[model samples]
Target: MSYCVGVDIGGTNTAIGLLDGERVAAKESIPTLAGEGPDSLFDRIAATVRGLLGRCGVPGDAITVGMGVPGFIDQEGGVALNSTNLRWRDVPVVARMRERLGVPVAIDNDVRMYVYGEALLGAGRGVRHVLGVTVGTGLAAALVSDGRLFYGGGSMAGELGHIPLESIPYRCGCGLTGCLETVASATGIARQARDLVERDGRASVLREWFPGEGMPGLTARDVSRAYDEGDAVAIEVLRRTGEQLGRGLAYAVTMYSPDVVLVGGGAAAAGERLLAPVREAMQRLLISDYWERISVVPAALGDEAGVIGSALYGRDAAAR
Candidate 1:
């Protein structure tokens, strides 16, 4: 049986897997060491794939490879143009991989893979319209309209997080002010919590949780714990975050009227602590005619979405 390799490259870590159709035959991770540049990163990934195939008793000729990354991508050519986190600029991903692996390769945006995974096997299964929201080191969205992932003119469509929220003044990681991501991402949530804790001078459970630690050192999980313990500040911070997320979702739904919205990534781990508020805000923002029918669900694929989605994309691309 023909097989495919899927790699999800991130700023800090990379997930690599082999897929025999939809079943993952092997999976592993390695430090992206992105600071070391693309040559080293790709070399390590290629080595990992070779190792995984060997361990699984699969032949190199039997497999292909696919990757999902952040930032602008030249999907047709498989070139990654300027991913700030990975520090890549116009990297010829496909040519390099093809030279080493002797197989066809495909690449696309990370969240697009998430959407593809959902459309194929997760919450978006059988749905004609799906919107995937990933809240992690950054926020991104992918839209599947009429059962196909929409790649707008520049292939940069569905960047929901980069949408500007006029009301918010916070600077975003993209170096732009007032982007929705600034107020709606995991890091953003942590930032708000830290700011509130420092400004309120309220006896924070976090203060006791980490004595003498600098306020900026607090993370999203720390705030999550505070919320679990009923800290009013943390509660308010997430509440606002959900509201911001809801506003963004509302705009997306109004435009595309997606049948379902799937939330994924690390922040989605907060579960109800995060979804409840976002749902509430979405309810308020959504028009009465559309509110009841639309639904939001967490990603069912979990961490496996990246590899699975990338493999699926590879299959389709190779067929074409």
Candidate 2:
């Protein structure tokens, strides 16, 4: 049987998987330590993929490779323009990979890859149109229509996180202020929790989680745990978070009117804690005619979404 390889590079971890169709033939994950820069990071990925292929007894000619990276990617050109998380600027990722892996390679924005996995194997299966939203350290979205990902003129079509939030006025890594990213990302939620502590000194489980340590140490998981324990402050933080994300999804719903909207990524781990409010807020923001027509569901593939999607992406590239 033929096989393909998929790699999902995140701020902290890089996941690699070998697939024989939908069955994962082998998998591995390693630290990206992205701060070390792209060359070092790519070196790690190449080594890991080489090992995985060897372990699976797969040849380079029998496998295509696909990769998902954050930030603006010139997928067709095989270049990564600007990946804020990786601190990358105009890097030739695909060309570099071809030099190392000796196989056909395809690349796309991480979130789009996640959504493609969803469209093919998870929540969006059989759906003709899909809107995929990912809430992790950052927020982003991708649109898939008639079973294909959409890239607008600039390959920046789904930058929902950069749009300004009315009340927030903080600078984002993207060099913008008051972005919806400030209120909706995992980092954004932690930032809000920190602001609440500074502004009101209000008592909540978050105070216990942080103590005198201050804001930088706070995390979205900590907030989720605090919320689970019925901390009013954590509850408020997530409520605001879900609502903001819901509004973003609402706008997407109104415009794309997709068959389904799939929510994924780390923050989505909060499950009902995040999705409930998102659904409620989306319903509140959308007109009655549109609210019931659109479906919003959690992404089912979790960490594997990007991997599977990437492999599938590569397979598609080879076909073309």
Candidate maximizing lDDT: 2
Error of 2 at 136 (Å): 0.8
State, as a TM-score between 0 and 1, how close model 2 is to the true structure.
0.94
| Model 1, TM vs. native | 0.95
Sliding window of 10 residues with minimal summed lDDT for model 1: 208-217
> lDDT tens digits, residues 124-196, model 2?
9999999998898788899989878899997879888888877777898768888888889889888888888
Q: What are the lDDT figures for the candidates, one per model?
A: 0.85, 0.87
Per-residue alpha-carbon lDDT of candidate 1 for residues 1-320, written as tens digits (9 for 90 to 100): 46888889888889999987778889999999988988888889999999999999998888778899888999987999978889899999988888888888999988898778877888888888888999886788998876577988988788888888988878876788889888788888887876666656766787777565456467777888899999888788888898899899989889888889889988888878888888998999999776787898998999999888888888778877
Q: What is the number of backbone collisions in each predicted candidate, taken in the order shown? A: 0, 0
Model 2 ranges off by over 4 Å? 35-37
